[model samples]
Target chain A: MPSDSSPPNRRGLITLAWLWVAAPLAYGVYELVHKATQLFTG
Target chain B: MSSPPVAPAGWSRWLVPPAALSVHLSIGQAYAWSVFKPPLEAALHLDGTQSALPFQLAIVMLGLSAAFGGTLVERNGPRWAMTVALVCFCAGFLLSALGAGTRQYWLIVLGYGFVGGIGLGIGYISPVSTLIKWFPDRPGMATGIAIMGFGGGALIASPWSAQMLASFGGDNDGIALAFLVHGLSYAVFMTLGVLLVRVPRTGDGGGTASGPSGPSDLEGVQVSARGAVRTPQFWCLWIVLCMNVTAGIGILEKAAPMITDFFADSSAPVSASAAAGFVALLSAANMAGRIGWSSTSDLIGRKNIYRLYLGVGALMYLLIALFGDASKPLFVLCALVILSFYGGGFATVPAYLKDLFGTYQVGAIHGRLLTAWSTAGVLGPLIVNWIADRQKEAGKHGSSLYGLSFGIMIGLLVVGFVANELVRPVHARHHVPAPREAADAQRQQPA
Candidate 1:
């Protein structure tokens, strides 16, 4: 019966969900950026 | 099991993307399989072609299985599909670990290619429709968020995997251990998706999905998967996807070699390190395009965006062919744009399907359309590889090696551009009856 309302604990879970996926994605991006910088370096 | 539990009232729609990402990011490791090839070839004493067999077969199985398992996903739900994908994919890795440890190359092929490929297929399409349902307000962005993970998967897997190989040593035991680690770690990561995912609650849940804001340019009608293939719109989109993918993937598959060849005879020959950088850069562009251009499609319309991908994309190919070596910066810019279009072409198609067919069975329909990708996977590389091999035989080097291939890709783009032009809304005869009408008719008949 509620619509789009998140309890504090549920909000924490949502944050974790996003972070769970985002952290790996960010790590991948970091590695890619490190490699990609070499194109101009040479 | 029956379908996974639907979301309770007030359950956040946002949870769905991570679930999709969990599956996609894991399966996306297929892109990084090249990292395993040299090690596998060295340890197993196989040729380059022989080593590539598992990745190639995995792609083939991805297409076939996705096309086949789509309806099952709609039947069993995302949690079930994710779990199955986790099992099959991880099991494939475990089997490959066993194979590598034992020096049985065939087992690696069976494990990684056949078993894991099914996981790739099923896992890939599992969350697509759910995302569409959740964010009908922005279906393009919804799908893009998850599908982009498939492109980005390699970025994460490639470096971590290389480090693992570097640390563990690239011997048979090392490779087996790496595969074991991947299987176990991915099992844990993907399980999060299975647990987090929930279908949207239907009917008197007090909260409705509410937003169905697909493109208004079309008739905006519903068509089941069966009726979808029967329409000309499907085949036209299929051809459009095929040609677009072939052109893009052709370059992607041969990227490092192609860039090196393009500049080999020139004064500014690309170094090996720079070439690796170029490949990494392309991966970035590819990953960015999935989220960026697909989200743009939500605003600009799918047909209009395909116009950009195919139309501008052909011009970029022509530029690369004629003047690629003239400037390194220019060449990189053109190639980057082309790769982005390639990635964009992939991410945009699901929304395009929703536009043409509506979301009735869009996942199944998308699965069927992926056969184009499977076809392109073979055709794209074949066209480039065959031509390059012939050129090598003739002692052709540098940009000349790819001139003919580029020309052929331009023609493919033209064919795709024409196919995009041919797309129109589905005809009224092909429509599934509106639910209210079907329900009304059923009531009259039963009495």
Candidate 2:
């Protein structure tokens, strides 16, 4: 396994963790709309 | 191959709790269910009571899940607690979608009720005890940070859900689609909480060297989760939380319709967009109260602050009820303040537990105490919606129907006010500390 070099500082870790949680959620919302459209109009 | 290095604790630990907050704040926004009431009711041609089931179920789940899952959360840690929340909350939506598609009211309740309610319970307490352990010196502030997320969950959820409902065609399909999105989206959001959360090492996580932190001044003062339940203070706090939540939710469940009715036939009647804004504003107040009032508790003490939430909150309801259909700004102002207190009541209670019960198993105790909230979740909306439905049939509308509802809320708040006054310091006999286990906390100086 590669040695993880991300989040060199505490603030960086907070930011990285936020991104980790947020990106997936934001993506999920986008996916939700996409799926919703396919269901409604498909 | 080398193992992953651990994070050197302190300040670095703040990262996980905030992620937990993000998920909680979003879901807590579900309380702003009134924001969607008109459009949903119109689209489905349903009555007020019919439209309220999802919101009621969500609150029921929040309290039930939190109460039932308290011990499991303490044993398994935040990761496990939050993982369960994501699955259930998301599945609730999927189930709700099927219900909406089939137009089966009971299915909607079953899906969101049993499935998602479990998620709410686990998610609510996922971080309480752990957060307290990490920051023994500032238990109030630490728990406040995470709980604030829950307070604000609705602030973000209200607007986003409204926009989703609007975009997805604003009918049963739209509502169904919104539920699906909420479930899937929350699962993804809460995944961060699960991924990053960790229990602090026993013995205050690093605040002390040898063992768990305890009162340095007192020779022995501790209360385990099991023991905490037996205390008068626990029951006192339970009554306090239940009464406070009931008062706030009574307004929250009916916010959209109530506000629209209050302003009916006014020169500047509330438009659709403006009504949505009213719900959004309440969300902001609810979210802000969590952080603002709860943080204030650190300085003022939980008892005094609750005196304000209950006492002042009751007074605010009086203002709304007496000044029937009064100035728009006054109505909005009083409602906002009341909603803030509601959110504050939730955010402050964990720290209240820390102050009274100690951190031995606070998360578990906090979970168990949440059953009061579950009880209020059912009672509050039932009282409001039930009365309003009865009034609607009796040719009542607008302020008249709600006048009765607000009167009931005032009585509940007053009852809560009495409970707050009855809170006294727990006696020695009631508190049961862990046995002296050669721990170093005995030698530490008190904060």
Candidate 3:
């Protein structure tokens, strides 16, 4: 077992996990914003 | 009290939020059900109201399953709970696919509404208590991160699902294929949450309560879910949540039309496209408020933040009631603010529960409290729609149609404000006895 205070190297895993959610969310927000522009434009 | 795969030494607590987001974002697709409605209605030859039954039932089931499954999730641990959510949620999509393929509306209802709703309920609460435990120092911000994904899920899902429907074609076979893709992909996505999640190791500094240093920090009070509902504080929070959700959902359900109606007779009438944009803006506000305002609660305190939601929310209603047609910007601003408060109310409550009732059985307690949401889900839209229908019958139109509804929302907000005021720390009597004390007491009691 690792020592109680030890910090494991999970930097890559964390990045991958965060990206999985963020990428799609960014896409959705982009579309939503694109659609929403019509309110001001029209 | 949770399942195994506890956070081993050296693990970063930060991984938990993404784990939670995986589940929340997937289930948050519930909000994007409207995207499927038009396609389903067209393929199934159903009217708007008939097509709506699935989403409505799904909401009801979300509350019911959450209220019931909360304790089981706490008892079995998050992994077991998350796996259950995965199975139910993914299976729901598959079943809906089968239903759509067969042209059976009731099958789709059963698949998505009943089965999938259980996934929503279980998935919704699964990460909440774990997040609170993981980030005891900043419970509001911690829970806010995970819950924010729920709001944002629709943002991603709305467009993505629409694209899928477009590419696959909106016919029945196409919709079925879309459902198949959603189920399979979501299954893959949610697996990350199940695999990555770990209950915090004891004495990790982040997981356990560091100490109850403040008078407001009643975490050491340790009330069980059963003990909590008996306390007035639970009911007060219940009323608080119900009224807030009711007030917001009323506006949200009617938003696209409400904005148009408010300005219908004015010099600047809101066009259909602008109305759609207005709905999108409200969704943005709702999603933003979940993370933004809930995190703000960490510094301001939960009670103070709620006072802002209820108090300011009531004022916004009053503004709409008295002078909605007077200015378009003012009208939109008030609606956006109310929606943010609606989302904020959801994100802040678990942390608020941690403050009053402590982390003991909090997931279960939260589950029980969600019954209030179920109540509000029906009540808010009912009050708004029924009044609008009645007003139309009375030959009313424009902003006049929603005047009474806005007044009722104000009344609900006032009630919520009072309920927030009534909330205090749970009494010592309600606190669950420590394990040792319980053992000793149990030994003395006759079998």
Interface root-mean-square deviation for each candidate? 3.3, 11.1, 4.4
Count of residue pairs whose backbone atoms collide, per candidate: 0, 11, 0
Q: Which candidate ranks first by lDDT, i.e. highest?
A: 3
Find the candidate with the highest TM-score and give its number. Answer: 3
lDDT per residue (tens digit) for residues B283-355 in model 1: 9999889999999999999999999999999999999998887888888998899999999999889989988
Over the stretch B1-447, how does candidate 2's per-residue lDDT look in tens digits?
Answer: 111112343445567566567557655656656766787678667799877877777777677667766866766666666777788878877998887777776777787767876777787787777666666555667777777776556545755777788788677787788878877877776776766766543332433322222322133355767778888888888888998999988988788788788878677666655665676567667767877888888888888999999989889988999884877778888998999999889888888887777666578889889888888877889999999999999998778888887888888888888887887766777676444532444435466
Candidate 3 residue-wise lDDT, B43-125, digit = tens: 99999998888888888888988998887887777887789899989998999999999998898899889999899999999
Q: DockQ for model 2?
A: 0.09
The C-alpha stretches of model 1 lying farther than 4 A from their native spots are A1-9, B203-220, B434-447
Q: Chain A TM-score per model, please list them.
A: 0.74, 0.50, 0.76
lDDT score of residue A22 within candidate 3: 86
Residue B252, candidate 3: alpha-carbon lDDT: 95
Give the DockQ (2 decimals) of all models: 0.55, 0.09, 0.47
- Residue B210 deviation, candidate 2, in Å? 9.2
DockQ comparison, 2 vs 3, better candidate: 3
Worst 10 residues of 1 chain B by lDDT: B209-218
Worst 10 residues of 2 chain A by lDDT: A33-42
